[model samples]
Target: MPSVTIHTTQNVSIDCETARIGTRIGAWLIDAVVLLVAYLVVLYTAEQFGSGFNREVALRLGPIFWAVLYFFVSEWLGSGRTVGKRLLHLRVIRLDGEELTPADHLTRALFLLPDVLFTAGTLALLFITTGGRSQRLGDIVARTVVIQDDPAADLSLADVLTIRNREQHRARYPAVQRLAEADMLTVQECLLRYRRYRNAAHREAVQLAGARLAGLLGIDPEEAAADAEQFLETLLLDYIVLTR
Candidate 1:
Protein backbone atom coordinates (compact mmCIF):
# COMPACT_ATOMS: atom_id res chain seq x y z
CA MET A 1 0.00 0.00 0.00
CA PRO A 2 1.18 3.49 -0.80
CA SER A 3 1.53 5.83 2.16
CA VAL A 4 2.01 9.51 2.78
CA THR A 5 3.68 11.12 5.77
CA ILE A 6 1.99 14.13 7.28
CA HIS A 7 3.83 16.35 9.72
CA THR A 8 1.78 18.03 12.38
CA THR A 9 2.47 21.54 13.60
CA GLN A 10 4.19 19.99 16.62
CA ASN A 11 6.55 18.15 14.21
CA VAL A 12 5.02 14.76 14.91
CA SER A 13 5.14 12.62 11.77
CA ILE A 14 2.21 10.35 10.95
CA ASP A 15 2.21 7.90 8.07
CA CYS A 16 -1.20 7.13 6.55
CA GLU A 17 -1.84 4.37 4.02
CA THR A 18 -3.74 5.43 0.94
CA ALA A 19 -6.89 3.56 0.06
CA ARG A 20 -6.44 1.00 -2.73
CA ILE A 21 -8.08 1.64 -6.07
CA GLY A 22 -10.29 -1.40 -5.70
CA THR A 23 -11.35 -0.21 -2.28
CA ARG A 24 -12.10 3.24 -3.59
CA ILE A 25 -14.20 1.82 -6.38
CA GLY A 26 -16.08 -0.38 -3.96
CA ALA A 27 -16.84 2.57 -1.70
CA TRP A 28 -18.01 4.64 -4.65
CA LEU A 29 -20.31 1.88 -5.78
CA ILE A 30 -21.82 1.63 -2.33
CA ASP A 31 -22.42 5.37 -2.23
CA ALA A 32 -23.89 5.30 -5.73
CA VAL A 33 -26.32 2.55 -4.77
CA VAL A 34 -27.39 4.46 -1.68
CA LEU A 35 -27.91 7.69 -3.61
CA LEU A 36 -29.85 5.91 -6.31
CA VAL A 37 -32.19 4.35 -3.77
CA ALA A 38 -32.67 7.69 -2.02
CA TYR A 39 -33.41 9.44 -5.31
CA LEU A 40 -35.96 6.82 -6.34
CA VAL A 41 -37.68 6.98 -2.96
CA VAL A 42 -38.00 10.73 -3.13
CA LEU A 43 -39.28 10.63 -6.71
CA TYR A 44 -41.88 8.03 -5.83
CA THR A 45 -43.04 10.00 -2.79
CA ALA A 46 -43.32 13.20 -4.80
CA GLU A 47 -45.36 11.46 -7.52
CA GLN A 48 -47.72 9.89 -4.97
CA PHE A 49 -48.40 13.32 -3.47
CA GLY A 50 -49.58 14.51 -6.94
CA SER A 51 -48.17 17.99 -6.38
CA GLY A 52 -47.03 19.34 -9.76
CA PHE A 53 -44.38 21.58 -8.21
CA ASN A 54 -42.87 18.75 -6.16
CA ARG A 55 -42.89 16.42 -9.15
CA GLU A 56 -41.34 19.07 -11.37
CA VAL A 57 -38.62 19.79 -8.84
CA ALA A 58 -37.88 16.13 -8.42
CA LEU A 59 -37.57 15.64 -12.14
CA ARG A 60 -35.48 18.72 -12.79
CA LEU A 61 -33.11 19.22 -9.85
CA GLY A 62 -33.37 16.19 -7.56
CA PRO A 63 -30.40 13.94 -8.27
CA ILE A 64 -27.68 16.60 -8.59
CA PHE A 65 -28.91 18.69 -5.70
CA TRP A 66 -29.36 15.71 -3.40
CA ALA A 67 -25.93 14.27 -4.26
CA VAL A 68 -24.11 17.53 -3.65
CA LEU A 69 -25.94 18.08 -0.38
CA TYR A 70 -25.32 14.52 0.73
CA PHE A 71 -21.60 14.64 0.04
CA PHE A 72 -21.16 18.03 1.68
CA VAL A 73 -23.22 17.37 4.79
CA SER A 74 -21.95 13.84 5.36
CA GLU A 75 -18.27 14.75 5.11
CA TRP A 76 -18.72 17.93 7.15
CA LEU A 77 -20.63 16.38 10.03
CA GLY A 78 -18.86 13.02 9.99
CA SER A 79 -15.37 14.53 9.98
CA GLY A 80 -14.58 13.74 6.35
CA ARG A 81 -16.52 10.48 6.15
CA THR A 82 -19.49 9.69 3.95
CA VAL A 83 -21.72 6.67 4.47
CA GLY A 84 -19.57 4.55 2.19
CA LYS A 85 -16.33 5.85 3.68
CA ARG A 86 -17.53 5.08 7.19
CA LEU A 87 -18.51 1.58 6.19
CA LEU A 88 -15.17 0.98 4.48
CA HIS A 89 -13.03 2.53 7.22
CA LEU A 90 -11.78 5.24 4.91
CA ARG A 91 -11.34 8.92 5.71
CA VAL A 92 -10.33 12.03 3.83
CA ILE A 93 -7.44 13.93 5.35
CA ARG A 94 -5.51 17.05 4.44
CA LEU A 95 -1.86 16.75 3.44
CA ASP A 96 -0.89 19.44 5.94
CA GLY A 97 -2.33 17.51 8.93
CA GLU A 98 -5.03 20.06 9.69
CA GLU A 99 -8.74 19.55 10.09
CA LEU A 100 -10.87 19.96 7.00
CA THR A 101 -12.50 23.36 6.58
CA PRO A 102 -15.88 24.21 5.04
CA ALA A 103 -14.15 25.37 1.90
CA ASP A 104 -12.39 22.04 1.53
CA HIS A 105 -15.64 20.10 1.80
CA LEU A 106 -17.45 22.41 -0.60
CA THR A 107 -14.65 22.31 -3.13
CA ARG A 108 -14.55 18.51 -3.17
CA ALA A 109 -18.30 18.31 -3.48
CA LEU A 110 -18.46 20.72 -6.41
CA PHE A 111 -15.56 19.14 -8.23
CA LEU A 112 -17.25 15.74 -8.07
CA LEU A 113 -19.12 16.75 -11.21
CA PRO A 114 -16.04 16.63 -13.36
CA ASP A 115 -14.20 13.98 -11.42
CA VAL A 116 -16.93 11.35 -11.15
CA LEU A 117 -20.33 12.39 -12.46
CA PHE A 118 -19.48 13.96 -15.80
CA THR A 119 -16.40 11.90 -16.56
CA ALA A 120 -17.89 8.68 -15.33
CA GLY A 121 -14.90 8.12 -13.03
CA THR A 122 -12.47 7.75 -15.91
CA LEU A 123 -10.59 10.91 -15.07
CA ALA A 124 -10.71 10.11 -11.38
CA LEU A 125 -9.13 6.69 -11.92
CA LEU A 126 -6.41 8.20 -14.08
CA PHE A 127 -5.44 10.77 -11.51
CA ILE A 128 -5.63 8.37 -8.61
CA THR A 129 -3.38 5.85 -10.34
CA THR A 130 -0.77 8.37 -11.44
CA GLY A 131 -0.89 11.07 -8.75
CA GLY A 132 1.37 9.02 -6.39
CA ARG A 133 -0.99 9.69 -3.48
CA SER A 134 -4.26 8.17 -4.72
CA GLN A 135 -5.89 11.57 -5.12
CA ARG A 136 -8.58 12.21 -7.67
CA LEU A 137 -9.33 15.52 -9.32
CA GLY A 138 -11.67 16.55 -6.51
CA ASP A 139 -9.12 15.51 -3.89
CA ILE A 140 -6.36 17.38 -5.67
CA VAL A 141 -8.50 20.47 -5.92
CA ALA A 142 -9.45 20.20 -2.27
CA ARG A 143 -5.92 19.31 -1.12
CA THR A 144 -7.03 16.03 0.37
CA VAL A 145 -6.51 12.28 -0.02
CA VAL A 146 -8.44 9.22 0.99
CA ILE A 147 -6.65 7.11 3.59
CA GLN A 148 -7.41 3.75 5.12
CA ASP A 149 -8.17 4.25 8.79
CA ASP A 150 -5.94 2.24 11.14
CA PRO A 151 -7.29 2.33 14.67
CA ALA A 152 -4.12 1.01 16.29
CA ALA A 153 -1.97 3.66 14.62
CA ASP A 154 -3.47 6.45 16.67
CA LEU A 155 -3.98 7.14 20.39
CA SER A 156 -7.65 8.00 20.51
CA LEU A 157 -9.70 9.28 23.44
CA ALA A 158 -11.01 5.75 23.85
CA ASP A 159 -7.45 4.50 24.35
CA VAL A 160 -6.85 7.27 26.87
CA LEU A 161 -9.98 6.25 28.77
CA THR A 162 -8.62 2.72 29.11
CA ILE A 163 -5.36 3.90 30.69
CA ARG A 164 -5.42 2.69 34.31
CA ASN A 165 -9.01 3.54 35.32
CA ARG A 166 -9.12 7.33 35.24
CA GLU A 167 -11.32 7.76 38.30
CA GLN A 168 -9.11 5.73 40.64
CA HIS A 169 -5.74 6.82 39.29
CA ARG A 170 -3.93 9.75 40.87
CA ALA A 171 -1.82 12.06 38.71
CA ARG A 172 1.92 12.03 39.37
CA TYR A 173 2.78 15.26 37.58
CA PRO A 174 0.77 18.33 38.47
CA ALA A 175 2.64 20.42 35.91
CA VAL A 176 1.14 18.37 33.07
CA GLN A 177 -1.60 20.98 33.07
CA ARG A 178 0.76 23.41 31.42
CA LEU A 179 0.97 21.39 28.21
CA ALA A 180 -1.60 21.70 25.43
CA GLU A 181 -3.42 18.76 23.84
CA ALA A 182 -1.09 18.99 20.81
CA ASP A 183 1.95 18.57 23.04
CA MET A 184 0.42 15.46 24.55
CA LEU A 185 -0.33 14.15 21.08
CA THR A 186 3.30 14.69 20.15
CA VAL A 187 4.34 12.76 23.22
CA GLN A 188 2.00 9.94 22.33
CA GLU A 189 3.34 9.82 18.78
CA CYS A 190 6.88 9.75 20.05
CA LEU A 191 6.03 6.86 22.34
CA LEU A 192 4.27 5.03 19.52
CA ARG A 193 7.23 5.46 17.18
CA TYR A 194 9.63 4.09 19.73
CA ARG A 195 7.36 1.16 20.47
CA ARG A 196 6.88 0.34 16.80
CA TYR A 197 10.54 0.42 15.76
CA ARG A 198 12.39 -0.23 19.07
CA ASN A 199 15.50 1.16 17.35
CA ALA A 200 18.22 3.26 18.89
CA ALA A 201 17.16 6.40 16.98
CA HIS A 202 13.57 6.11 18.18
CA ARG A 203 14.75 5.42 21.72
CA GLU A 204 16.93 8.50 21.58
CA ALA A 205 13.96 10.55 20.37
CA VAL A 206 11.87 9.37 23.33
CA GLN A 207 14.70 10.20 25.74
CA LEU A 208 15.18 13.67 24.33
CA ALA A 209 11.45 14.37 24.38
CA GLY A 210 11.19 13.10 27.93
CA ALA A 211 14.02 15.36 29.08
CA ARG A 212 12.58 18.35 27.30
CA LEU A 213 9.16 17.79 28.83
CA ALA A 214 10.66 17.36 32.29
CA GLY A 215 12.55 20.64 31.92
CA LEU A 216 9.40 22.39 30.75
CA LEU A 217 7.50 21.00 33.75
CA GLY A 218 10.35 21.99 36.15
CA ILE A 219 11.26 18.43 37.05
CA ASP A 220 14.90 17.70 37.90
CA PRO A 221 16.91 16.47 34.88
CA GLU A 222 18.39 13.62 36.90
CA GLU A 223 14.96 12.22 37.72
CA ALA A 224 13.96 12.20 34.05
CA ALA A 225 17.29 10.72 33.06
CA ALA A 226 16.95 7.84 35.49
CA ASP A 227 14.26 6.18 33.37
CA ALA A 228 13.20 8.49 30.56
CA GLU A 229 10.68 6.02 29.12
CA GLN A 230 8.96 5.51 32.47
CA PHE A 231 9.02 9.24 33.12
CA LEU A 232 7.25 9.93 29.81
CA GLU A 233 4.74 7.16 30.42
CA THR A 234 3.87 8.63 33.81
CA LEU A 235 3.46 12.05 32.28
CA LEU A 236 1.04 10.65 29.70
CA LEU A 237 -1.05 9.09 32.42
CA ASP A 238 -0.82 12.25 34.50
CA TYR A 239 -2.02 14.43 31.63
CA ILE A 240 -5.01 12.20 31.08
CA VAL A 241 -5.82 11.97 34.78
CA LEU A 242 -5.48 15.67 35.54
CA THR A 243 -7.18 17.04 32.42
CA ARG A 244 -9.96 14.55 31.91
Candidate 2:
Protein backbone atom coordinates (compact mmCIF):
# COMPACT_ATOMS: atom_id res chain seq x y z
CA MET A 1 0.00 0.00 0.00
CA PRO A 2 1.02 3.63 -0.55
CA SER A 3 1.73 5.99 2.35
CA VAL A 4 1.44 9.73 2.65
CA THR A 5 2.94 12.12 5.19
CA ILE A 6 1.15 15.27 6.19
CA HIS A 7 3.33 18.35 5.85
CA THR A 8 2.74 21.79 7.24
CA THR A 9 2.09 24.56 4.74
CA GLN A 10 3.56 27.12 7.09
CA ASN A 11 7.31 26.51 7.19
CA VAL A 12 7.93 23.42 5.08
CA SER A 13 7.88 20.96 7.93
CA ILE A 14 6.49 17.43 7.95
CA ASP A 15 3.70 17.12 10.48
CA CYS A 16 2.94 13.44 10.89
CA GLU A 17 4.31 10.60 8.82
CA THR A 18 1.97 7.78 7.75
CA ALA A 19 2.24 5.01 10.29
CA ARG A 20 0.53 1.64 10.48
CA ILE A 21 -3.20 2.12 11.09
CA GLY A 22 -3.16 -0.61 13.73
CA THR A 23 -1.13 1.31 16.29
CA ARG A 24 -3.29 4.38 15.81
CA ILE A 25 -6.40 2.31 16.46
CA GLY A 26 -4.71 0.68 19.41
CA ALA A 27 -4.04 4.09 20.93
CA TRP A 28 -7.65 5.12 20.37
CA LEU A 29 -8.92 2.05 22.21
CA ILE A 30 -6.65 2.88 25.10
CA ASP A 31 -8.06 6.39 25.28
CA ALA A 32 -11.63 5.13 25.10
CA VAL A 33 -11.02 2.85 28.08
CA VAL A 34 -9.70 5.78 30.09
CA LEU A 35 -12.72 7.86 29.22
CA LEU A 36 -14.89 4.91 30.20
CA VAL A 37 -13.18 4.69 33.57
CA ALA A 38 -13.65 8.39 34.11
CA TYR A 39 -17.28 8.04 33.19
CA LEU A 40 -17.73 5.12 35.56
CA VAL A 41 -16.01 6.91 38.40
CA VAL A 42 -18.36 9.82 38.12
CA LEU A 43 -21.36 7.51 38.11
CA TYR A 44 -20.06 5.45 41.03
CA THR A 45 -19.20 8.43 43.16
CA ALA A 46 -22.73 9.72 42.74
CA GLU A 47 -24.16 6.31 43.72
CA GLN A 48 -22.19 6.27 46.97
CA PHE A 49 -23.19 9.77 48.05
CA GLY A 50 -26.94 10.06 47.13
CA SER A 51 -29.50 10.48 44.42
CA GLY A 52 -28.29 14.06 44.83
CA PHE A 53 -24.80 12.83 43.99
CA ASN A 54 -25.91 11.05 40.83
CA ARG A 55 -28.66 13.30 39.55
CA GLU A 56 -27.48 16.65 40.78
CA VAL A 57 -23.78 16.93 41.55
CA ALA A 58 -22.49 14.66 38.79
CA LEU A 59 -24.90 15.98 36.20
CA ARG A 60 -24.04 19.56 37.05
CA LEU A 61 -20.33 19.17 37.67
CA GLY A 62 -19.50 16.41 35.14
CA PRO A 63 -18.49 18.70 32.31
CA ILE A 64 -16.24 20.90 34.37
CA PHE A 65 -14.76 17.95 36.20
CA TRP A 66 -13.90 15.98 33.05
CA ALA A 67 -12.65 19.10 31.33
CA VAL A 68 -10.24 19.81 34.13
CA LEU A 69 -9.40 16.13 34.34
CA TYR A 70 -8.45 16.12 30.69
CA PHE A 71 -6.42 19.24 31.14
CA PHE A 72 -4.49 18.49 34.30
CA VAL A 73 -4.48 14.71 34.61
CA SER A 74 -4.38 13.73 30.95
CA GLU A 75 -2.40 16.69 29.68
CA TRP A 76 0.03 17.55 32.46
CA LEU A 77 0.65 14.16 34.08
CA GLY A 78 0.30 12.17 30.87
CA SER A 79 1.53 14.83 28.47
CA GLY A 80 -1.66 14.70 26.45
CA ARG A 81 -2.10 11.06 27.29
CA THR A 82 -5.38 9.55 28.42
CA VAL A 83 -5.48 6.19 30.17
CA GLY A 84 -5.73 4.39 26.84
CA LYS A 85 -2.80 6.33 25.46
CA ARG A 86 -0.62 5.61 28.47
CA LEU A 87 -1.21 1.88 28.13
CA LEU A 88 -0.72 1.97 24.39
CA HIS A 89 2.39 4.14 24.53
CA LEU A 90 0.77 7.00 22.68
CA ARG A 91 0.09 10.65 23.41
CA VAL A 92 -1.58 13.61 21.82
CA ILE A 93 0.13 16.92 21.15
CA ARG A 94 -0.31 20.02 19.13
CA LEU A 95 0.49 19.75 15.45
CA ASP A 96 3.78 21.49 16.12
CA GLY A 97 4.68 18.90 18.76
CA GLU A 98 4.28 21.41 21.55
CA GLU A 99 2.48 20.73 24.81
CA LEU A 100 -1.21 21.31 24.39
CA THR A 101 -2.54 24.25 26.35
CA PRO A 102 -5.68 24.24 28.49
CA ALA A 103 -7.56 25.93 25.68
CA ASP A 104 -6.58 23.18 23.31
CA HIS A 105 -7.77 20.59 25.79
CA LEU A 106 -11.07 22.34 26.31
CA THR A 107 -11.62 22.84 22.60
CA ARG A 108 -11.08 19.14 21.89
CA ALA A 109 -13.33 18.12 24.75
CA LEU A 110 -16.09 20.39 23.52
CA PHE A 111 -16.13 18.51 20.23
CA LEU A 112 -17.18 15.37 22.09
CA LEU A 113 -20.71 16.77 22.41
CA PRO A 114 -21.73 15.34 19.06
CA ASP A 115 -20.74 11.85 20.15
CA VAL A 116 -22.55 12.22 23.44
CA LEU A 117 -25.70 13.57 21.84
CA PHE A 118 -25.96 10.81 19.27
CA THR A 119 -24.89 8.10 21.71
CA ALA A 120 -24.60 6.06 18.53
CA GLY A 121 -20.87 6.47 17.90
CA THR A 122 -21.45 8.01 14.47
CA LEU A 123 -18.89 10.72 15.01
CA ALA A 124 -16.29 8.19 16.10
CA LEU A 125 -16.96 5.91 13.13
CA LEU A 126 -16.53 8.80 10.76
CA PHE A 127 -13.20 9.62 12.32
CA ILE A 128 -11.94 6.03 12.24
CA THR A 129 -12.82 5.64 8.56
CA THR A 130 -11.60 9.06 7.55
CA GLY A 131 -9.00 8.93 4.79
CA GLY A 132 -5.31 9.98 4.88
CA ARG A 133 -5.39 11.26 8.44
CA SER A 134 -7.32 9.57 11.22
CA GLN A 135 -9.20 12.79 11.93
CA ARG A 136 -12.10 12.23 14.25
CA LEU A 137 -14.63 14.91 15.07
CA GLY A 138 -12.51 16.11 17.96
CA ASP A 139 -9.24 15.74 16.09
CA ILE A 140 -10.51 17.54 13.01
CA VAL A 141 -12.04 20.23 15.18
CA ALA A 142 -8.71 20.49 16.97
CA ARG A 143 -6.64 20.04 13.76
CA THR A 144 -4.80 16.98 15.00
CA VAL A 145 -4.05 13.43 13.88
CA VAL A 146 -3.75 10.22 15.87
CA ILE A 147 -0.49 8.37 15.35
CA GLN A 148 1.58 5.67 17.01
CA ASP A 149 3.69 7.19 19.76
CA ASP A 150 6.41 4.83 18.62
CA PRO A 151 6.98 6.17 15.13
CA ALA A 152 9.72 3.63 14.47
CA ALA A 153 7.53 0.57 15.04
CA ASP A 154 7.36 -2.01 12.25
CA LEU A 155 5.18 -5.12 11.97
CA SER A 156 7.98 -7.49 11.05
CA LEU A 157 9.40 -7.12 14.50
CA ALA A 158 7.25 -9.00 17.01
CA ASP A 159 8.40 -6.89 19.93
CA VAL A 160 8.47 -3.13 20.29
CA LEU A 161 12.09 -2.39 19.37
CA THR A 162 14.50 -0.03 17.64
CA ILE A 163 16.94 -0.88 14.86
CA ARG A 164 19.92 1.00 13.46
CA ASN A 165 20.98 1.76 9.90
CA ARG A 166 24.06 1.26 7.66
CA GLU A 167 26.71 3.56 9.09
CA GLN A 168 26.07 2.38 12.61
CA HIS A 169 25.80 -1.22 11.50
CA ARG A 170 29.51 -1.19 10.60
CA ALA A 171 30.52 -0.56 14.17
CA ARG A 172 28.19 -3.25 15.44
CA TYR A 173 29.09 -5.66 12.70
CA PRO A 174 32.73 -4.50 12.49
CA ALA A 175 34.02 -7.40 10.41
CA VAL A 176 31.37 -6.89 7.75
CA GLN A 177 31.75 -3.17 8.38
CA ARG A 178 34.69 -3.18 5.98
CA LEU A 179 32.43 -4.24 3.14
CA ALA A 180 31.92 -1.54 0.52
CA GLU A 181 28.57 0.07 -0.20
CA ALA A 182 28.36 -1.96 -3.40
CA ASP A 183 28.55 -5.21 -1.46
CA MET A 184 25.84 -4.16 0.95
CA LEU A 185 23.75 -2.97 -1.98
CA THR A 186 24.21 -6.30 -3.71
CA VAL A 187 22.50 -8.12 -0.85
CA GLN A 188 19.95 -5.51 0.21
CA GLU A 189 18.80 -4.81 -3.31
CA CYS A 190 18.14 -8.45 -4.04
CA LEU A 191 16.43 -8.92 -0.69
CA LEU A 192 14.36 -5.81 -1.11
CA ARG A 193 12.90 -7.18 -4.34
CA TYR A 194 11.97 -10.60 -3.01
CA ARG A 195 8.23 -9.95 -3.22
CA ARG A 196 8.56 -9.77 -7.01
CA TYR A 197 9.76 -13.37 -6.94
CA ARG A 198 7.32 -16.28 -6.50
CA ASN A 199 6.84 -19.58 -4.57
CA ALA A 200 10.00 -20.32 -2.56
CA ALA A 201 11.43 -17.17 -4.08
CA HIS A 202 11.49 -15.27 -0.81
CA ARG A 203 13.24 -18.13 0.93
CA GLU A 204 15.78 -18.83 -1.81
CA ALA A 205 16.58 -15.16 -2.25
CA VAL A 206 16.97 -14.75 1.50
CA GLN A 207 19.42 -17.63 1.58
CA LEU A 208 21.58 -16.23 -1.21
CA ALA A 209 21.43 -12.67 0.09
CA GLY A 210 22.28 -13.85 3.56
CA ALA A 211 25.27 -15.76 2.12
CA ARG A 212 26.59 -12.64 0.42
CA LEU A 213 25.81 -10.44 3.44
CA ALA A 214 27.47 -13.00 5.69
CA GLY A 215 30.57 -13.17 3.51
CA LEU A 216 31.03 -9.41 3.77
CA LEU A 217 30.36 -9.38 7.50
CA GLY A 218 32.54 -12.47 8.04
CA ILE A 219 29.65 -14.42 9.56
CA ASP A 220 28.30 -17.85 8.73
CA PRO A 221 25.70 -17.83 5.94
CA GLU A 222 23.40 -20.16 7.89
CA GLU A 223 23.64 -18.08 11.00
CA ALA A 224 23.19 -14.86 9.09
CA ALA A 225 20.12 -16.22 7.33
CA ALA A 226 18.61 -17.17 10.66
CA ASP A 227 19.30 -13.73 12.08
CA ALA A 228 16.82 -12.08 9.68
CA GLU A 229 16.99 -8.51 8.47
CA GLN A 230 15.38 -7.20 11.67
CA PHE A 231 18.14 -8.53 13.93
CA LEU A 232 20.76 -7.17 11.57
CA GLU A 233 19.07 -3.80 11.53
CA THR A 234 18.68 -3.85 15.31
CA LEU A 235 22.41 -4.47 15.65
CA LEU A 236 22.97 -1.56 13.29
CA LEU A 237 20.76 0.71 15.33
CA ASP A 238 22.34 1.20 18.76
CA TYR A 239 19.14 1.84 20.70
CA ILE A 240 16.75 -0.96 21.55
CA VAL A 241 13.25 -0.61 22.99
CA LEU A 242 11.95 -3.58 24.90
CA THR A 243 8.31 -3.45 25.96
CA ARG A 244 6.45 -5.93 28.12
TM-scores of the candidates in the order shown: 0.67, 0.46
> What tens digits encode model 2's per-residue C-alpha lDDT throughout 115-208?
4334455776666566556555776667655554542433211121112233322334546545544454454344334423334766576566
TM-score of 1: 0.67
lDDT of model number 2: 0.51
lDDT of each: 0.80, 0.51
- Cα-based lDDT at residue 16, candidate 2: 34
Local accuracy of candidate 1 as per-residue lDDT tens digits, 1-244: 6988776443445666799999889888888888889889877876787556466667678878888887888899988888888899888888877778989999999888888888888999999999999999899988898988755544432234344445666788899989998898788778767765678999899899989998899999888899777788788778767775
Model 1: residues with Cα > 4 Å off, grouped in runs: 54-57, 152-244
Per-candidate clashes come to 0, 5
